[model samples]
Target: MPLLKVLRPTLPILVGASIMLTLGMGLRQSLGIFLQPLTRDIGISVSDFTLAVAVQNLAWGFLQPMAGALTVRYGFRPVMMIGSVFNVIGLALMAMAHGLTSIIIGGGILIGIALACTASAIAMSVSARAVPATVRSTVLGMVSAAGSLGSLLAAPIGQVLSEDYGWRAGLAGFVVLSILMIPAAWYAGRVDRVPLPKTSGDEIGNTSAGVAVKAAFSNASFLVMTCAYMVCGMQLVFLTTHLPSYLAICGMDPMLSAQTLGVIGGFNVLGSLFFGWAGGRWNKLMLLGMIYVSRSLILAWYFMLPPTPASTLLFGALMGFLWLGVGPLVAGAVAEMFGLRWQAMIQGLAFMSHQLGSFLGAYGGGLIYDALGSYTMAWRIGVALGLAFGIIQIAFALIRPLSPPPVLKAA
Candidate 1:
């Protein structure tokens, strides 16, 4: 099995997508490390910072479908290149911010839009288009695994720099990293040159975006998956946005948050590989349900106990193993349902649901903490919602297995 021979043609695209994904997601996820310093220095509340993050998610979600559709009209290269530039500008603004308006514009609006073009959805779509269907899921998993390394590197670098210098310096460090996205996006744009693979007559590969979106919304399984995806966003974003503050409240060292994030990134590689492989063999929606269930249980267990280095690290490892695995599963499932032509857009539609949940997780958690001065209520709600959604996802998957929606030829 000469894997290299098979992948050689598309290797550059995959590599570029992976690097873009790593830095884009990594740097964004690590922003929580700056919350304390940024808020205190700017004389803003925790809720303010979280609000910007929430807006970022909202912007990312709302613009994703548009970005994906543009990829269909234009090529991925141009859309992604523009996004890479946005990432640079956004980070630069954050690094120089003296007020909330700047943070909202840079961190919330621009970076949010940047992610629409550079993060998981776009990255996964690039990989899917670059490879054969036979190996698409595995390759998606591999790329996702590789992309997970960004947080591992970003967290420690930002945390160290911020601790020694200032929050702005940490963001400046991220700006340097984001510049690399320009070249990565250019290379990944090469996938635009690879003609879309042929699909069955029944698949909606040639449908207009309007028609395809209608068909996607009409499907029951996709709807269920999209709803469950919201819970996924809620749970994951809550952690990334608030976990450092939680640790700080617990009197843990600031460095622990970065280390924990690094651990999660390390484990993301394994989770992506495992779930990517599992998705090809098992039911993707069911796998998603199980991951959510496991995450809720872990959340319950971790937050219930006092924070220790060992326990915190363990939580990071466990949680990390479950993180980003969704990239391959969701991406693969979208491709299976809609075909590659609109996979990015359809996935973006689902991601809109996920981002709505992210808005809740990031902002809602902050609001609760501000009011109560404890995260007890927030985590409780998250766990309850996660368990309910996970069960629903698993049950719905078992009852109504996924099938592609009908596509009518353009009249």
Candidate 2:
């Protein structure tokens, strides 16, 4: 009752955004489950398949700013509706594909574009506009947690479908689920009707989107945060894309890999919530620094320990707790610094940098494994990058409060 009472004002936006994230991110997270099966069926190397998936990440990042601009101008519903169509079509194409070309076109290009529209950037942007500033971080966290729930549920479900019927059927089933996002998109579009408060003279409200972009690009803190997000993207995609394969390579049961992903998803739910609450109450940049530092330490411990079911589960649980927790904090920081007038566009650019990292992590893991016959090099690189980024984040914490940019008048 207390929770409901607190959320009642923004419940629709929260529910709609959560559902959209659930289907959008859930399906994306489940792609790892398809790695072995799809490759086996198509007779392609893991590197090839990974390259396609990497393309998907790149495309997602490439299109993010466009999607944000569209959402800002036309509202979220139409963008979501079109995105749902792209997802359904893309999944169907992936199901029918017999070669890497088709897979890249379907899974990489179309689905990548679809995710740009349906993913957290749009969800957070709309939710930020709909909710009061006081509770924005919490709502963003709730939405992210919902997406994690999708990640949790999708792995096992995809495994079951792939194991029972076939991987193709599994993709088809996801197509059905993706269609559900259309309605959710419609519901989330209602945020456009909820008027946002006008910004004070000091805010960037009077400036053009071009000016806001220039200001964010010029801000040292924003630049640092964007760079830090690159590490987040790389680490996240590497784990999501390769964890199952890594477990299989270690001679663990395939099912355990799926379960590990599910575990991560489960823990991510709590992690996102906790980080969300903490972001509101404490220094968010410091929280990010700690998260990266913890990730480096966790990976070290995981490598040191023997690969077993218990170790794998523990790793997943710990990693899951850190998963996606940065999202709300990053979005909240952007809102705090820049205001919401161009929040979507600015955040979209930051996320684009994240996707660049995703591109490297996802594709590079496969390339390394193919070349070296193990993921050792890739994991080691992640550890080093995590530590370096962690320190960089802490340094950012020392920066003074950002001064708002000059407001350029619109023609």
Candidate 3:
């Protein structure tokens, strides 16, 4: 008897998608470690660093919808290749940066654009298409968790690289990694962008890119998700960018700060997996609301409690639980309402809102600290935003879906 071959179509897509997430998220998150060294060399205040990061985030936000459009006109492989190119250029420029302005151009603008083009939303959209509809949330969660693995390890690895070599060498190291992505992206080209069966529905939508944008803008649900994501961006970027510095300010050792960040990253993987499980078993909207509420409550409690190593670690753990886990839920929501065919474009547009919030969170926290002589005001503001997110998501959940708008058959 001849050996039988078993078909396993989803496996390649999963592997390709996961690799993209790990590299994209891991490298972007590690940029935070360069903040101090870059500032000292440039002779700029921390605020300058903050502003540059903020602008970088803003660039990511502004470019997202456009990239999504490109993904529509082009295909996943092409867009991802463009992203990899930008990543290499941005990191090289940043590594060789001299002045404050140059760093902004390198670290803020280029890197931000690169991340928007190739990161979580783009990769997970592809992963979403590769799986069964019922497994959508789980697949998205796995993707987020994969990225978190990068986030989890980035701090320690970045620290070690910076120590063994130097900050410049560390930056150079990632630039090399970005080069590797070029090949990975090219290989990803082998996977079909447009689904097989070449049936009418395989295409993402018949609605033109402009029409889809207009429809998404018109949808109240989309608006609510966008607004809620702003808070998500703010909270996430602020914590990730400044948490190490903040720990230092609190009189903790740098090693301890690195450890805290690592733990936060580790916890995020668990958080994403657990929430994804809940997303499949429960009402996704409600789960989203609860995540926000939990964040708000945790921030409030952290503020009320005295600062201690034990307290900080506990807070970091809780924050980790709510971290990128939101990615899968939010991305899943986009796929749920819209179609996965245009998943990258739609999610990119949504993420633009997120990066805008990130701009605010990252730079705003620095401004708050510099102005107030402490981070008190910033922490308080985070609590307020958390509450706001909860409210927005809850209100969105109450609104009825618009009769599942005509599923424009993709040709």
Measured by TM-score, the strongest candidate is 1
Candidate 3: where are CA atoms >4 Å away?
1-7, 193-204, 399-403, 406-411
What is the TM-score of each predicted model, taking all chains together? 0.98, 0.95, 0.90
| Colliding residue pairs in candidate 3 | none
The stretch of ten residues in a row with the least summed lDDT in candidate 1 is: 402-411
Ordering by TM-score:
1, 2, 3
Ranking by lDDT: 1, 2, 3
User: For model 2, which pairs clash?
Assistant: none
The residue-level lDDT of candidate 2 at 17 comes to: 84
lDDT of 1 by residue, 7-104 (tens): 99899999999999999999999999999999999888999999999999999999999999999999899989999999999999999999999999
What Cα-based lDDT does every candidate model obtain?
A: 0.93, 0.84, 0.74
**In every candidate, how many clashes are there?**
0, 0, 0
Q: Clash pairs of candidate 1? A: none
Lowest-lDDT window of 10 residues in candidate 2? 402-411
- What are the candidates' C-alpha RMSDs? 1.4, 2.1, 3.6
lDDT for model 3: 0.74
lDDT of 2 by residue, 186-254 (tens): 888888888765532226765677877887887777888789888888888998899888887888998
lDDT of 3 by residue, 80-134 (tens): 8888888889889988877777778878888888877778777777767666666
